[model samples]
Target: MEAYCSMKAQEVRKLIREQVITGQTSGMATGFTQANLVILKQEHALDFLLFCQRNPKSCPLLDVTEPGSYRPAKLAEGADIRSELPSYRIYRDGVLAEEVNDITDYWEDDMVGFLIGCSFTFEAPLLAGGIPIRHIEENRNVPMYKTNIACTKSGIFEGPTVVSMRPMKAQDAIRAIQITTRFPDVHGAPIHLGDPSLIGIDDVSAPDFGDAVTINEGEIPVFWACGVTPQAVAMQSKPSIMITHSPGCMFISDRKDSELSVL
Candidate 1:
């Protein structure tokens, strides 16, 4: 894990493309930015772009690929979006059809890929600030849940907002808010803190996506809008087809985390 944390983004991406690394990417490629992927046909691209524009917090744009091009020019150079990510989820008519290590078979000439900012980009700063990320400590994926809070609809895109949670003490939570606020592209700041029930989470121990972690006494759960929100939207919107990174498995980009930070 330590070796992976110190590796360059391109090295990590190479391993992933070869299917050597096929799991969550939380602590890998420490200082680089990571992104969530969303692929749709050219016809649906405009509507989805509008969807992302309206829900900036959950779907902040990182770099979008040109139609028929698998390369994310702005985020990664000489990297193929079709296979660079560890894992992918294929959706057909809004229903998840299959999970694959590569999407080359599904790629279309008119397909447009959208790279959304991922919260993993901000985890390094949180750790540097002395905040212990329980999921990282436990070697598990960060827990994510679907909230009752509805996202602003754009075209056929409409669904409940999704969020990822981290447990920390009150002081650490406050510090995290300040540190993360600098990176709005990466789902900056906690949208909700304390009780999960307030956000329609029935049980914090059972998350809608990813793995659950220990929440110590006196520690509160901090919720941040998640890039996975698009997955939920895909289910609701029922597009003809969509492809995305599986929950927690992200595309490691050449861009540095600091590049996305406002500070």
Candidate 2:
């Protein structure tokens, strides 16, 4: 696992497709872009694309696949979305059906996959800027929450925005905000900082997804619009079927981190 941290994006995707790696991708494939997956039938693609456009902060569009195509031509070369991700979540009629290592059984001719930018991409820059990522330091997945702030609706997709949280002291939080703002494709900057309740999170220690890390005495929780927002929003619409990357599990893209930076 430690060695995988230094692996290139393509190498990491190869390992994932072979089922040799099946966990969160927070620190792996450093300096590469990691994406959130959302696959739906062609019937829902347009509306979902509109939903994404309406909620750019939460669902920054990275790439999209043609109907029935698993290859993400723009983000990765020769990458099969069905088998390249570490894990996939299958949703049926607004409910989580199951999680699988591969989506071959569920792949349909009319399905379209949407790749959304993930906050994980900015973690590398944050570290370079001297902002420590607590989850990476503690060897745990970064905590994510389902917030009370409702996302703008488009067609059937409508729900509260989900957010990823990192607790940091006032100064670090401010620096993190600046560091992350340079990458608009990867959520840019935090949507909220300080109280978790302001976003409707009842407990900071207990997250809706991923593992919780200890928050130091002076650190306050910083919240960023999360890629998982689409998954949560899509589920609310209760489409006949939907698919997404399991929380923390991501699709490694060939694109470099520098490509996503605004500066």
Candidate 3:
């Protein structure tokens, strides 16, 4: 795992293309911006875009594809949406049919893919700040929870906001807020800090999606609006056709993480 941990973006894609990497891609491509994949039909493009805008906290706008465009022009050049990602979920009228290593068979002429930002891009900064990401340290998926907070509505896409939790000490939590605020395009800043129940999270030990991490005493839970929001929202809407990277598997982009910085 350590050998693959420092792999290049192209190398990571090769593993994904060859179906060699089956698990989550949280820490594989260190410096590159790993994006959340969302594919939809042309008809839902405008509505979904607006939903992303209205709920920018949960859905920061990234690169959107033109109708029938599978290749992302802004994030990763010469990258295929079908094969670059490790795993994809096929949603039929809002129900998940099955998980697959690729999605070439379901491709449509009017399908457009989106590459939204993910918090995985910020691990470099957080670790530099001496804040340990529980999942990365534990070799497990980051804990994600569905919050009681409702996302701002835009057209047909609307649902509860979902957040990823990373337990940190009080001082580290403050530093995290400062560090993340610099990267607004990647779901900047912590939306909620401390007390899981305050944000509709009943138990910190359990998560709606992903594996749970141990929270040490004197460390508080910090929550950030996650890239998973789109998948959760898209599932509820159930468009005729919608595709997303399976949880923990993300699309590796050619763009550097620092390029996403506002300052």
Candidate 4:
């Protein structure tokens, strides 16, 4: 993992494309910006863009591709969105139909890919601030749960928000909020901390997506709006089709994390 942590974004993407890295991208290509992918037909692009606009906390825009183009010119030039991520999820009529390592076969000329800001992009800064990220330490995907918080409606896209969790001591969580607030492009700061029940999460031990980690005796679970919210929206909006990165398996971009920092 240390070897992967030191790799350049392009190198990490190469390995992912070649099926060398087939898991969550939490600690890989450290310091580079990571993004969540959502691909849809041109007809649905406008509505989805509005959806993102209305729900910036959960779907902050990073780089969006032109119709029929797979390369995200602003994020990772020349990189193929169809196969760059370690895993891809295909939704048919809002239901997850399949999971694959490559989406080349499903690509359409009218497809537009939206790369949303990922919380993983801010994880490095959190670690640098001495805030230990439990998922990275436990070598597991960050736990994500559907929240009662409803997103603003945008066309057919409307659903409860989803959030990623990281258990931290009170002091570390405070520092995390301070550090992450500098990167709003990514889901910045903790939306909720302490009790999971307040956010409609009935069980912290079993998450809606990803793996749960240890929430030590003195630590509280901190939650941040997650890029995975789109998946939940997809289930409700029932789009004809949607393609997204599997939860926690993100696209590693060439952009540096500092590039998105406001401070």
Which stretches of model 2 miss by more than 4 angstroms? Answer: none
The Cα error of candidate 1 at residue 14, in Å, is 2.0
Candidate 2 lDDT by residue in tens digits, 38-96: 99999999999999999999999999998889999999978999999999999999999
Overall lDDT per candidate, in order of appearance: 0.92, 0.91, 0.87, 0.92
- Candidate 3: residue pairs that collide: 94-238
Q: Which 10 consecutive residues of model 4 have the lowest summed lDDT?
A: 22-31
Query: Candidate 1 on 97-212: residue-level lDDT in tens?
Result: 99999999989999999999998888888898899999989988889999999999988999999999999999999999999999989888789999899989999999999899
What local lDDT does model 1 show for residue 176? 97
Residues 37-145, candidate 3: write the lDDT tens digits: 8898888998988888888877886798778978888887788988889899988888998899988998999988877889988878889878888888898888999
Q: Which residue runs does candidate 1 get wrong by more than 4 Å?
A: none
| True-vs-predicted CA distance for residue 184, candidate 1, Å | 0.5
